[model samples]
Target: MSNKIKLTVLGLLITLNSLKAQQTSNKSYDVCIYGATSAGVVAAYTAAKYGKSVLLIEPGKHVGGMSSGGLGLTDIGNKYAISGIALDFYRRVGQHYGQFEQWIFEPHVAEDIFHTYLEKAKVPVLYQHRITAVKKQGNVITEILLESTGPRSVGRVKAKMFIDCSYEGDVMARAGVSYVVGREANTAYGETFNGVQLTNGHQLPDGIDPYKVKGDAKSGLLWGITKGQLAEKGSGDNKVQAYNFRICLSNDPKNRIPITKPAHYQPERYELLIRQMEKRTWKSLQDVFIWSRMPNQKTDINNRNGFSTDMIGMNWDYPDADYRKRQEIWSAHTDYTKGLLYFVGHDPRIPEHIRAEMNEWGYPKDEYMDNENWTHQLYVREARRMKGALVMTQHHCEGREMVQDGIGMAAYTMDSHNCERLVVNGMVKNEGNVEEGGFGPYPIAYRAITPKETEAANLLVPVCLSATHIAYGSIRMEPVFMVLGQSAALAAVKAIDGKSAVQEVDVAALQRQLKENPLADGSAPDVLIDNSDSFRVKVSGKWSVQKRGGYGPDYFLSDGHTDSSSFIRYYPDPNIKGRYEIYTYYAKLPERKAVTAVKVFDGKRLQEVVIKDEEVKVVGQTSGEWVKLGDYIFSGNGKPYVEITGNGEKVAADAVLLVAASK
Candidate 1:
């Protein structure tokens, strides 16, 4: 059947389901998780595992959000910081592939893992149940009404607690939660990278024109080009970050389905891309096409460089738009992306080599079988972020501020995708792509997910929790979402047990529980060092102590300008003796020095060894973990020590671990 006809039939089935569900009475549960995303599924599994009745409500036919969608190439920064249910999910994915754990896999494989987790937890999922209305009584949510789109009709779910795990924060917004869309000013939260960043990074090729007619001011701006005076940097605005589909493409003939022009292909929409190609402004198509390898030779394709997969400036209305409007936006994105693919593969204007390369890849026929080989979920990178009891800001991610009641940790860079395509100095430039990093793993406060007491007391927002734009960029990773989902579930359970508001849950108790509960395999590390232990420091310039969660609460950072004369040294116990491998843990950030020199003093010799600190590379997948420096022999009576000297870049000096290597 044609795509339109299939959608019509699906709509009719949903109407019939809604009508059927309206005839039944309201069902009660201990927890109602709206939007069966990866976060929602994990929340349901967690609540159900704790013996609470969970209703997993999904607005669409499928679940598992982006993970089950085409975003199979995980964007994990510090994999070691990921534990509990988040780690379990990856381990399950690994199990399916006959490995200990698989970080990259097929979309269907991820969906299978979600299904297994939910099924094992015995949680029932209600598909096509979009939350229509949320009933609130004073401070608590009384119930939620869902309109069915398939076989069930209108259904009411009464739960003591509700978790908004949707990417859009639909349920939370309906429940009168305060949320802010788009970018906030840096001054609003003392953040340097928050708002209106036109010149920040991710600029298009230097000479691309903004007008449809080159050099003609009267000519209207090209499609997708915003014509306006660029906003001052660090100022707040309503423009949201870009969104796209994490497309799954394949080169294997057995699975590849060649990109075809959409039914409503609009060549004019791609005028800018064609212009760039014709002008020979870009080096290669690969500059825009970032295809990361997934399992089975498939690829999780993403937008990169200038004018890529991200439909810039088209998703501002998505967070608040009604269901029908969202469908329209989704269709527009699909057409734009598919058209780009088709143009790259067929347009003669594209270089022949690039065209040939594009033609080799297409949608994987075996994936997204139910959705015409397209991913069901859109990459809603940023949307309506809730302004909860505690708003997480760049300060938190940078370790300038720390949350004592941290439920989990996020260790990724404070990254933001391009937010606007603007006319700058008579040329087209993409704005708001700030990729700042330096701070290590930071804690996610429980209060950040909890709504204010005056708002709904029972609601917890995990995916769309309280955070600034730059901070959200780091927190929006799938693994971090899963971690927050599990933490939200535990907090809900605690609130229910204590008969207290979600905002009033005892934080100390929550922290204690979280720390005490190790992984199911009992592999969590024990706290061995006290915070009071101080390393002797001699600084020629300046240094400061910064505390974050995954970095064992305290670490030292050099000033942005590093000098060779500045260094920090630490002396080990005088009695230590044996061949030991030295490992240094620092926040892996893009802005870190490519190499940091560590002066090691072994009993036999003193030598300087260079350590590569770039965290972006997948070297042993040890971004946040202990990175080995070198093995050295220490005498039992000598004062063995190590010194870190600056190399003119940002340097993080967290605690070092000395493991005994086999002699």
Candidate 2:
């Protein structure tokens, strides 16, 4: 046997012997987390930081899954959502870029940071330990079976609680928990953006078809285009979101690695892309949306325009694929993407301009040098979603509904890429291709992360929660996953202390903990309109209005004060009850305007309102004068009032505030 294999076997033998000896004794841990995913690492570190003995088991040789892998460009929706240890990771990354090390995308930098954190927390992470089975007792999980690859032996771990931090939900799956793989029907949850999108967004140019041949009736439809099948609209499909390698590329001639032809490079495989290029339908890589981290020597090249790096409409089988099958899928994806680059750079089929431009780009030698300088991880956008205690849908994100059991907050817009399949309505299209802007951040319910009672009692799935495809689009971000991971660890600790199942844990208590130890990342702009503020309210139509009053009688607006000399007064028309609508046409301003606040009053109190300013301006266009920035409605908690205010008396209102009955 080879020396590496010999060492691996010896390591496994030692591990097995140690585990067997410990089994005879009473060596138990407070918490155990399977999978050394980014979230898993955070879970273990956070739990250990909180004084919990954590046994972190990583099946793969690598610790940080996608984070330290290829996904160097972080997908943080709202930076504020990142708090706790998650923010600590970024802060540490920021620190590395201080004066000497300008580039922070180096794999060693990230790995070193994670190692230092684990060392600091005194958390023990065992690599090459795959969790094969989970043994449960009554309402609690007793022991988990971990198979070692080095010695090829099995070891068992007994812990008070378990966290299925693996992206595949390995522990939860092995425990026989109820989960889902593909898109759900719109009718199942009355959702609009769940399965099989076919609409073109603002990014994709118009009149461009997604079909293979331009209405070729003789040869029939082209390859890669899924059409002619009898399919219902807005119905569920056996499809999942796309996944890709977070390629860390460098342009520094010294460290840059040029595109290489794979051993299995097939010219025929790139026929479609070549055809698209010939048709002038392909979007160049350099032209793709570039989000720079510390100015343009480096950038996070995301899937932008029509045909970027997002291998959509082909990843429908990932959420439910087995291990071996997942590997095959990964290999196929890597070949396709890497081959695409090779073809673009050297293939004769590619256009001259595109080839010349592609030649100028190469891999970043400064990053991920261990694996021949290639990114170690693929960015799996969506995977197996757990059917937990509560499900988060688009309505929750759209402010149509509110989650009372909020353990954490999601401050990102509902974002998803195009899942195009074929041509429709005489045009090439894809569904779930929405990029609607202007919606404010909303709260993510804690219940969405908890598993069902029948599932593993101690298991908490924060990354892959019970959310629809559209909803997961917003929550699948890395920072959000880290925030939820911290919250999950906190919940695990509380559940262990209470000696109750994960589902049985009090959500109110969880919410309390989160608020008490909120992420100290940043602060929200201090902007609230109370009774102290005065106003010059304007009105139009059959309704009446006031400036500095609230929802009251003669005041014509809700009565509240924000600051001294600055109060708002609102009054609802007796003729209108239930639901009332208002419009603000225009406003004049005072001076000290730091931010803007719009409050709605409901006789007794202030209701949900929106606040805006330069720091938090609403982008893009809107339907009405009011863009409906935030629903701001909360259940079981009432601040029912209506008023708009700024720091100084200087405020501008363009539209009139109209209140009509709810229809």
Candidate 3:
């Protein structure tokens, strides 16, 4: 079906299924956070850390939005930009595995880590409670109506400060925040990467033309291509980023569950893919996801190769969708992706090699058991960007203009999913997943998290901030979300302290607090050292060490379907078991010259471990070092340690570089 028709049907279903319930509570609190995403969790925790009463309202059963959901692969651009609570989250993750962290890992590990944060903060999480009504008076929000799924489920509460951390900006929308959805024309932001373009830079299989009939205009458009009104390139439209479920796959014979045909699975749905394969234009497996953990016994399969299950150009209307309509959209995407998997695994039309490769992977029985082996969360990339006091545009990201009120920094290039589907010269083509190069990390403005001037006075939005389509793509990462979440909470507390709206919070003071708490950048007076690698760890004035390497193909695919260049490892050494000590402490630094030598000290003398460097290349992407450290060599009291005494005044001692592999 065409996108327009799918949107119309989904929109109508939303209208029909929508129901408004009555308000029942009148009590108020100090702070309120809407949408129980990772950002929401951070915001609430920050507010509570400041000794304020916080009420967290979630629209679903789960609290961690994309973080705990299927998106186990966290897209944290610049880790250094993430500080405060956000840094804490990854630190906790690293702690869980007793090793350096990566972007993509197991989903359950993410869930356990997030819940650990919530429990530590002692925040009240009201699940299965959707906000029914939001009332505002002048610059202040009076109260919000929340309806629960259980008996006596209706209640209302007022809050001095509110935050919208939802991916869709639902709370901000209900509170009357002005926002824009979909991509903006190039002229709108003077951004070269904003609008639709088929540069073939990130295209699916070459020669797999979009049009059905090759080089014949008379042949007409093919199936799934929307027939009505085509918006001009770079022009504004209701279109948004694509959404997909992160499939958790495994090759463990004991735990792997083969892809079973869904009850509604239809072979016809996959005919399009088969046609492409028949023409010898089948998609390659370069970017297929295979997440490796530290105790390397598990695997998390992700989109590694092109044409993987990212239902691109299909989720334009989801950000503002009502509950029921959202459900329908979710169902459609699930069916589409499931069918894709089934087609790849079972369809006889597929290449024997491709089918054999796919058959080797299946859902891990140990993960997401509650959802019948399906990921519980549908990865929502770009949603409603709540237009706030300051709109973070492409200019801010390109470093042409620095946000004075920097809460955090984003180092990733502006990355957007394939946003358009077109047939060029009778070949099927897709566009919009643009990737820019050479652009380092840029600071995120505090205003991006605040409510619109006309919206609620105290609410803060961290997850869905005020950014243009391309800009949001870069900022909408997990670590950045956590940083913004903490910043939002800090601002809320400051507002409550000063009796002012979030819009009116002092920028200078906010900056000071942010620096102290240091969510945006790790640059802080108290921090001893700060260094962060793109898509990895970030610390505050603290020195950290990472031993980076990729797992084997059974552990981490060098080439898959989702992203060929993505550094993913699915296996780690299991037989070599040993406990490594991790220490976090404040210390004074001694100035020195460049490094003379590197040594690992285990209390008395130097320690050693076997380091294996493997040259495994993932097609169409960068190669990674597959390093292995002997577990027996790095154990005991203060074991597997690195002693680096270089030049510096102070450095926050975060983690010891237990392992390091030169690529």
Scored by TM-score, the top model is 1
TM-score of each: 0.79, 0.72, 0.75
lDDT of 3 by residue, 152-251 (tens): 3547768888888877787788888788888888888688778775555445566664445655656666555554444566666667666777666777
**Model 1: residues with Cα > 4 Å off, grouped in runs:** 1-25, 278-284, 518-663
After aligning candidate 1 to the native by TM-score, how far in Å is the CA of 159 from where it should be?
A: 0.5
Query: Between 2 and 3, whose TM-score is larger?
Result: 3
Comparing 1 with 3 on TM-score, the higher-scoring candidate is 1
Models ranked on lDDT:
1, 3, 2
Q: Which stretches of candidate 3 lie over 4 Å from their true place?
A: 1-26, 100-103, 149-152, 205-222, 228-232, 279-306, 517-526, 530-596, 599-663
> Given candidate 3, what's the lDDT at residue 298?
46
Q: How close is candidate 3 to the true structure, as a TM-score?
A: 0.75
Q: In model 2, what lDDT does residue 182 have?
A: 70
**What are the root-mean-square deviations of the candidates from the true structure over C-alphas?**
7.8, 11.6, 11.6
Q: Each prediction's Cα lDDT score? A: 0.78, 0.61, 0.61
TM-score of predicted structure 2? 0.72
Task: Let me know the TM-score candidate 1 reaches against the reference structure.
Answer: 0.79
- On lDDT, the stronger of 1 and 3 is 1
